[model samples]
Target: MNKSEMIDAIAARTDLSKVASAKALDAVIETIVESVAQGEAVTLVGFGSFKASERAAREGKNPKTGAKILIPQTIVPKFAAGATFKARVAGKDE
Candidate 1:
C-alpha cells in the first residue's frame, strides 16, 4: 500500500492519528536512510536487514546500438528479508 494507506492502517492498529502515524513513519525512514548513508545496517528481528552492497565496474553492451560500454561501479542499497518476514510472506508463521 501507499504511504497514506499505510498510515491509516497503522492508525487503526495503534490508536494513533493519521498525522502521528505519518510522523512516525517519516522518522523511521529518515533513521534508516541516515544509517545506510553512514555504512551501517538496520535490522528488525522479524522483518529484514537493510544494508549496502558494492558493485564492481563491468563491461556492458548498449541494447539499442550493440556497442560496448564501461559501467561504473557503485554502492547500492539492499534488503534481505529475515526468516520471519519470509515466513509471513509465504503464508506461514515462524
Candidate 2:
C-alpha cells in the first residue's frame, strides 16, 4: 500500500488521528534513514533491520550499447526481514 493507505492503517490500529499517524510514520522513517546514513543499523524486532552495506566495484555491460563499463563501489541501504516477518510472509506463524 501507499503512504496514505499506510497512514490510515496506522490510525485505525492505534486509535490515532490521520494527521498524528502521518507524523508518527514520518518520524519513524526519518529516524531509520538518518541512522542508516550514519552507518548504523535500526532493528524492529518483528519487522526487519535496516543498515548500510558496501558494494564492491565491478565490471558491467551496457545493455543498449553492449559496451563494457566499470561500476564504482558504493554504500547503499539494505534491509533484512526479521524471522517473524519472514514467517508471516510465508504463511506461517512464529
Candidate 3:
C-alpha cells in the first residue's frame, strides 16, 4: 500500500492519529535512508535489513544505438528480507 494507506493502517493498529502516524512513518524512513546512505546496515527482527551495496563498473550497450559504453561503479541501497518476513510472504502458517 501507499504511504497514506500505510499511515491509516498504523493509526488503526496503534490508536495514533493520522498526523502522528505520518510523522512516525516519515521519521522511520528518514532514519533508514540516512543510515544506509552513511554505509550502515539497519535491521529489524522478523522484518528485513537495509544497507548499501557496491556495484562494479561494467560495459553495456545503449539499447537504441547498440553503442558500447562503460557503466560507472556506484553504491546502491539493497534490502534482504528476514526469514520470518519471507515465510509470511510465502503463505506459511507460522
Per-candidate alpha-carbon RMSD to the true structure: 1.1, 1.0, 0.7
Clashing residue pairs, candidate 3? none
* TM-score of every prediction relative to native: 0.94, 0.95, 0.97
Output the better candidate (1/2) by lDDT.
2
Residue ranges of candidate 2 with Cα displaced over 4 Å: none
lDDT of 1 at 84: 90
Tens digits of per-residue lDDT for model 2, 1-94: 9999999999999989999999999999999999999999999999999999999999999999999999999999999999999999999994
Q: Which ten residues in a row have the lowest lDDT in candidate 3?
A: 85-94
For candidate 1, give the lDDT of residue 80.
Answer: 95
lDDT tens digits, residue span 1-94, model 3:
9999999999999988999999999999999999999999999998999999999999999999999999999999999999999999999946
**Model 3 clash tally, residue pairs:** 0
Q: Per-residue lDDT tens digits of candidate 1, residues 1-94?
A: 9998999999999988999999999999999989988899999998999998899999999999999999999999999999998998999984
**Model 3 TM-score (2 dp):** 0.97
Q: Among these predicted structures, which one has the highest lDDT?
A: 2
Better of 1 and 3 by lDDT: 3
What is the C-alpha local distance difference test score of candidate 1? 0.94
